[model samples]
Target chain A: MITRVDHIGIACRDLAASIAFYERTYGFSVFHQEVNEQQGVKEAMLRINGTDDGGSTYLQLLEPLHAESPIAKFLERNGEGVHHVAFGTADVVAETEAITGTGVRALYEQPRHGTFGSSINFLHPKDCQGILTELVQSPVHE
Target chain B: MITRVDHIGIACRDLAASIAFYERTYGFSVFHQEVNEQQGVKEAMLRINGTDDGGSTYLQLLEPLHAESPIAKFLERNGEGVHHVAFGTADVVAETEAITGTGVRALYEQPRHGTFGSSINFLHPKDCQGILTELVQSPVHE
Candidate 1:
């Protein structure tokens, strides 16, 4: 079983520029912004209109802050915009097992730390239908 | 102004296999499925939970039935899972104009035929931050 959308991840070369764009153009407000050194990314969570308290889904803007970061490579090859969609899952291992049983590849052999303190794993885009799928298991509440 | 998520596009290599995975694992039901010869894609709509009926949010699974399809190229470069996130806008023309003014390239200069017959325009991923974005305007009277 799965819950709602956790976050929509976007890879950007400049967080400030993209942040300004969403704020000025769409009125989306940044709820939280942090740098995950482990993941080599600086991310900002922008709440969608009318969901400021994290009650509704949010936009995650990721800026690689480093040269060799995967985000940078992604930008170099694909350019900017929708990177991945993180979905809330009841059980990451079970869901991943289910997916792998179908002979699809999981990005991580096991679960890994995700953006915003969420436990997440990326299902290989090849395993999925061409979209990079993130399986997120959030804290039992919220 | 924006409402909520319109849908996430998933580019699949196999329409039938992806459909079965989403339906069985995620509990999504098919809203609509079709083959668009011009687009070179076979698309299937999966209703994301909590957004049913005229629900604005859903997932569009797209399989490049032809090798020359753009979706096919996306698959070749990026693999699969989540392609783009569509946002529901109050005014498509206004939004398109605003975004275009910001230097974000629109796949089409104007809204065009979309899944489920919605008026939609795609923003070039290059300008937005490595993530593909879509703007959707529903025909249903508000």
Candidate 2:
């Protein structure tokens, strides 16, 4: 079962610049920052207002560090913007099955390791009517 | 201060078909439906996991009812997909002012009426890195 919105991912060419824009303009505060060497990108998470439990959810901005990163490709094709919206789900595999059963293409046949230690899968935007949907299993903090 | 994510708006060609697809595929239920003639859209709100307290906001499918509707133009240009991600705000006017003062383009000079009796103002996707951002005021119950 899928639940509330987890976060909206935005891909940008310059992570620092975009973060400055969001923070200065929207009052969004940076929660954390990291560089994913495998994805070849640096990311910053921003906490927006309205979080009930210390703002457990936030938006992620990704800046590709290399030309071969998928984020780079997405930025090149679609430009800097929303990459995907992540939804917290109980069973990503089941949700993928459910969505794929409707003839929507699932980018991943099974859930893969997601950022912040979550299990996630991607559904192609073509099948999702142009909005890339990502299903993520929220990480349980010990 | 806006904190948590409120809801994501998806622009669909057919609201009924989209609603049926979401319900049948994802087990979401339609909680509310309304047509904002001024915005030129018939919107159907589907609750995720049947939460009705507005904690987990539903997916809003927008179907443009007129040729000149802004949604219709969006569809024609961008095709069917996620239109905007609305962040719930306690003071939309203040948020709008803050957002616009950043030198980013806002689609509306002032907050306009939105479906479900909420006030909303749109920030241009060009300014927001291709992701349309909407500042939505708290819902007014009838």
Which candidate has the highest lDDT of all? 2
Candidate 1: tens digits of C-alpha lDDT, residues A25-102: 666789989998877899998865332222356688999978888888878886776777877776788878876776
Cα lDDT of model 2 by residue, B111-137, tens digit? 899867888888888888777888788
Docking class of 2: acceptable
Residue A38 lDDT (model 1): 70
i-RMS, each model, one decimal: 4.9, 4.2
- In order of appearance, the predictions have TM-scores of 0.80, 0.88
- Segments in model 2 whose C-alpha atoms lie over 4 Å from true places: A38-40, A49-55, B49-56
- Cα-based lDDT at residue A53, candidate 2: 24
Candidate 1 regions off by >4 Å? A49-55, A65-68, A76-81, A90-94, A97-111, B37-40, B51-54, B65-69, B72-82, B140-142
Clashes by residue pair, model 2: A49-B2, A49-B3, A49-B4, A50-B2, A50-B3, A50-B4, A51-B3, A51-B4
Report the error of model 1 at residue B62, Å. Answer: 1.6
**What does candidate 1's lDDT look like per residue over B30-65, in tens digits?**
988888776788999776544322344668899997
Candidate 1 at residue A107, lDDT? 80
